[model samples]
Target: MGESDLIHLDVVGLNPAIVKHEKQEKAEFSINRKCYSHLKKKTFATFVASKRISSLWHCCDEAFSDSLSIHRHVSNVHANEVDMLISAALDQMSNQSEADDSVQTSLNECQAKDASSWMPDISHLSEDKFSEGPGEVILYYRYCQIKEPRLIRDWQNELCSRLHLTGKVRVATEGINGTVGGTKTATSLYIKAMMAHPIFQVMQVEDFKTSDGGADCFPDLKVGVYKEIVPMGVDPDVISYKLAGTHLEPDEFHKEVQSLLNDGSSDSDTILLDCRNFYESKIGQFKNCLAPDIRKFSYFPDYVEKNLDLFRNKKVLMYCTGGIRCERGSAYLRSKNVCKEVYQLKGGIHKYLEKFPDGFYRGKLFVFDERYSISFNDDIISDCRYCGTPWDQYQLCSTDFCYQLVLSCTACRQKGLTACCPLCQVKGQTSSRSPTSGRVHKEECECTNSRPRIPTDTS
Candidate 1:
């Protein structure tokens, strides 16, 4: 985003502690600085020949233009090590599928249709091919606009087989921004089929860049119509956060925080707030971020509406994961008749950690999907329960029967490898070696760790 569209990082309560870390790391680029053009040049596109990403984009500073390069480094130099692991994972999935009849498709003729129009159920999808590795899927989008709706729904029903995906996509007038999962082949076919559509022939796309402008795109496939492609305009209680608006990078937001810190006559009057769920805020929050009786986005508004008198005339700063929530959240505060400057981090702590690792954010930031949690910038923010080492990377149980993600530290792993859980570990390890053994499927995979859980009754 351009500089004007930024929210102040300072409002997120990131300063001094964070600023110090960035300067030392030499990663201290101003998050608020509008280097859109400079960063854009590094903007690359690739139609990944086939979804065999050895290296997901690594945030290795600016040394590499993209993560693909990092993947290349790991794969080319350490191909043998990666291959062994991949083989092991795939074998595990194949064996697990044998045990679970549900994982395999048992189609009935009644559900079949020819030259058809039927929306497929999301529940029926599975990424079977991921037994080899984290399957790669590519989605074809038309420019920033999606004018076709009926076609998408039909595609969902007739096209997408029983493929698995992380389900969080919506279609809207603006465009699409949902995430799902599928096997490498399924995702690839879906993208190819999308381009074959005559209606979208003239459309521009950003997703294709992943393949370097080639036909070899996604490895798996599934395209469908969601409530909202991006799900931006939804109910007041949909996603977490009270606000939703354009975001500011960390740099610009930090400047504002400095002002707030200096504006106060004394520190006591400074009202701090942690505008996130108790679970999220607990991991790490600003020194003064408030922890109120709120869990979901819906209850957050009520908390401010009923208890705003405490900071009716004080400088109150708030923040959330992404800056989107503050858009709606801040508006609710305005209606309370409490006159105070409402501020939030543009992209929440995520942007802050990009530059300042050991900043105010103390632990791992929880995510909604299978990725579970990612480490904050520098320190081992959160501890691994088993070994007590700082670890935030989430792994689902490796057992195909139990694909639920569980937080595990380095020492917690069963065989010095990340699996879905101990159940998956027992299943994968004990199974007799198979032809497809160790090909894919870590068994430790899920959509997200924390979804938008609304407040029912927070006691």
Candidate 2:
């Protein structure tokens, strides 16, 4: 290709000024180098051809001549970007009345180029780096538009498998929420990889809340595409993070909690709310915060709907385990328009304890893993269910069919107070013990009544 043809291909749809500058520079250089201009043109054509081939296989640096191999490579590796581009093109076409096949072809070419521009080279991440020290568990979530969740899920599965990490990852059209545990080096590399990804580039190092643990913290890796990353049991399109409450940094949240504590009056207009479930708060929670008695996160909407009077005209300060719940929870609460104002902890309790280990939050932070909970301070805010002894350790109910977690001190546990309640203990004794019987057919206990099912709000 000649200089003008190469320039046109390189600067297609780019700024007119940039194209003009490129032409001017070419003209200036060509005047004195006319003798070798033909050779330069041949070299440029070869370079451009190789560059185009490399662009087509952006994920891996391999260039394939076979169309089938190229298709396989792109689908297996760059499926997420491909889906995103197709979705964008469709969206653009839908908005334009005169859009045709030519318009779509042009749009796809432009979007593909743009997508490949931001893809980072992960070829060097072939080997896992092992560290000597203990591993860490990272808890993080990002709310952004993901055009194809399944492709993201595939990518996450492959990445986590390669790093030998274990944990749960929930992907949705709205975003991704994950808590992976691995070696210090592996976790560090995972964070770097996530930040390098175009979809998650908005994330910072601090966004991944790390705690002392490793792959063993979780039983296995479970990554899946879901309706909502956090499963608020509401349509993500209806209650999105965009409509979430204002975020307050750890310092600001600390001050707000301190202010609430300082105010001894019962009629304060501001309310400190724990957005976590009852069990989570039972172990540890902010001092004097109103923790709802909901069993599952899905019930949060009903809890709010029923208790609207409590939040009416009140400035609500909300917090959760790692901030994922509060994102959609706060949005749901705000949708009611009952509260005067709604604000959530920027990074939730995790970020709060990082800054102030002995801050307003007290006791152990509950986590959904084998570890059960991680402590920041020496505070034991909870008590044994059987005896009112100060304890925060959680153990599963001894009843085989019951999945409920109960707190029983050493003394009580030794005395066979292992069930969630006395009734469950009696039932466990009378019922036929079968090895095959599991929590899937869980018998209703007294605690079951507390979690009354509410119709899902599809609105």
Candidate 3:
């Protein structure tokens, strides 16, 4: 590319005033060891200052391909100018009340050459110093009204791109739900940018459940307009947040669980219902909770209908992964007036684990990502489908066209864990089954049909 083409101002948004500032006499700008830490706080002043510094480096990148080369060029030729520009940016930022005092002090102490040198080698700061290591992950959702979902989706895409984040975000008239991952810095910038948006003005920054991981959690960024953040398959107008169940704090939930256990009433007045899909509950759940055996969330309403008698005169406590599902699920139940009272885990199991890790919930938390599952405790609740050993590690069936996932122990897998279920195994052995039609016939595994054979433990 030509120099002019490569140095296009679109990426820089560079103003003539910035060039004028660069021409001024050099002032020392120290690279503070703690500068990256302060950048993560999400204060407006810090965000703006970081954006400016990022822009300055972005412009510098346009002039040179290799960061080391740019560091050398700036150190030898434009060290003073770059320092002056940074000083000007820092000076402007220092006037803002939200800017960290340490940030300004660090910039002032940095020697231009040394500072330029360090900026190019930022990848080295990947240790414990940062709250989020290089590739951290997060799951956040907001149940709020959106006037323009398409516009919000477009804006979200640009924001995620700018921050080098990848994940899926679904926006609708009802709200938004997403689980995304990136380097700690990228995800931090994304949260800052998202909070600044007017559409998400009411969103509580603390509501986001940030976990340690990397961008590999999601394959790519996918933002789109959806009907609901958590699909309950109901009209949005029928239910609202005001009608949702009471939210119990983590400690409160723990206390309540203790009370329930103490009551020792076989005919309990309260119910702890797991609102997640059957597969999710198969791996992990709270002790003594009533986890429905439904295949998908869509069956939840029907489940409630069939079990209306169970909810009568009872205080029901419902929960899901991140709380969004329970938000609507509880609302739907409350609207029916079948239960005496309804409540849900404030932030769901994710938040509950934050306060009380390995307390009540057990086994691995099955996540819809490349990581598949995360452990809360060493307790393995489920047994290997093949060997019947105490194992919770789940994997897709070895059958190419079958999408069923089952718990297969290492020993079982080694012993030729082939089909998802016994029915599939029998079908796989027959030449009549086509590879494309390897999916087990749902009817064959249903209650009406013969139950799928559970492999007897051979070991």
Candidate 4:
């Protein structure tokens, strides 16, 4: 056969079998042959050549050897004309195959399949529904080795910014810890993104503890790479989470706490230790738990050092706000070689409250945000620091320089007892009087000095 006849046979006969075989014989040979004939007549190469010689202004005289290069060229240079060019090319291909009935039928089937594939599957979008509210806040942390924390930090910053989230995110080689607030949709998206991340695939939707609040709960967005996701004032290299305490689920921890409560013997060997700071435990804590009086988390190491006798040969149960602190805090306690055993609440009070809101936990759960506390039950355990009335709400001391929080009730606050302590009140009054006071620096105060050297009995 002549070259033209050979080309026609190759396009019409041989190509069909190849295409049919590749499709696992799904398409009949007759249909495949018709498809190939249409494709060969309106080949992409012919389309590229036609475009090069057309009256349309081209960016450069360079010829592309492949479709990818041509696509790149068109996208980079004639971006504004991309839709027009695509429509023109589709019209040209359709016109070439309009005469053949079999070709038109095959094209219709293929176009239907292609269109279905392009149509987005909205099945997974239904999972995005959250509680009906203006917004929400998500608290989550993971302890895994991250070789490139800076990359993770950058990704977090970009993701949170795009979602219009406001909160603090800390990334380290160990992992990431954050509590972000945004619209329910945004928070839901953030959770999905975290679950999809390669480094954080181990995380589940349950790992994220959500509460009612929004972007307004925080002042602004802050994301950065840090030495430790949760600052414990100890190197993670030395006190690793791998050496941390055994994890107890909410139910398991509840049972354990119940057992502790039931045992009235003085020889009870287990101890419930609150790993959170004083300001946190001040409002709420597990019944009879030994809560440290340290102001900041960085002071925890020293507290453990000085109070080593308390945990000596005892089974210690440690817990914190969202379980991140207890991970490192338990590790630090374990490093001291004093405790016989250490166990932590798996998801902390956050998860426990979800499962058992009205269970053993009482009062409000202190959170680090504009919403100072969140409550599950209306149990008033703590009293106002000023009037001694039952109150659990916390507010920042009115003194600009003092960072202490005041547990003063609304009644006391109305009576101008907003300061954290007498020293803070005196300082605030003095600072407000002098225009040239220039902010006096006070290091030690009654509030700091009055903190118990050891745990006090709250029962």
Backbone-clash count (model 2): 0
The sequence of per-residue lDDT tens digits that candidate 3 reaches over residues 344-435 is 89888889998888688877787878777787678777888777888887787665545667678888778776566776666556624555
Regions more than 4 Å wrong, model 2: 1-132, 432-440, 448-459
The C-alpha stretches of model 3 lying farther than 4 A from their native spots are: 1-133, 429-459
| Cα distance off (Å), candidate 4, residue 175 | 0.5
> What TM-score, over all chains together, does every model reach?
0.41, 0.71, 0.67, 0.70
Looking at model 2, residue 90 earns an lDDT score of 31
lDDT of 1 by residue, 47-118 (tens): 121322322233323233233465466556544544444334334433554455323111111113232323
TM-score of candidate 4 versus the correct structure, residues matched by position: 0.70
**Worst 10 contiguous positions by lDDT, candidate 4:** 20-29
Off by over 4 Å in 1: 1-165, 171-177, 180-247, 258-272, 380-459
Query: For candidate 2, lDDT tens digit of each residue in 248-327?
Result: 77988888888988996899999999878777888888887888877789989989999999999999999998998999
lDDT of each: 0.44, 0.73, 0.65, 0.74
Spell out the clash pairs found in candidate 4.
Answer: none
| Candidate 3: 10-residue stretch with minimal lDDT | 450-459
lDDT of 2: 0.73
Q: State the weakest 10-residue window (summed lDDT) of model 1.
A: 102-111
- Model 4, 270-306: lDDT tens digits are 9999988887887778887888878789889999999
Relative to the true structure, candidate 1 reaches a TM of 0.41
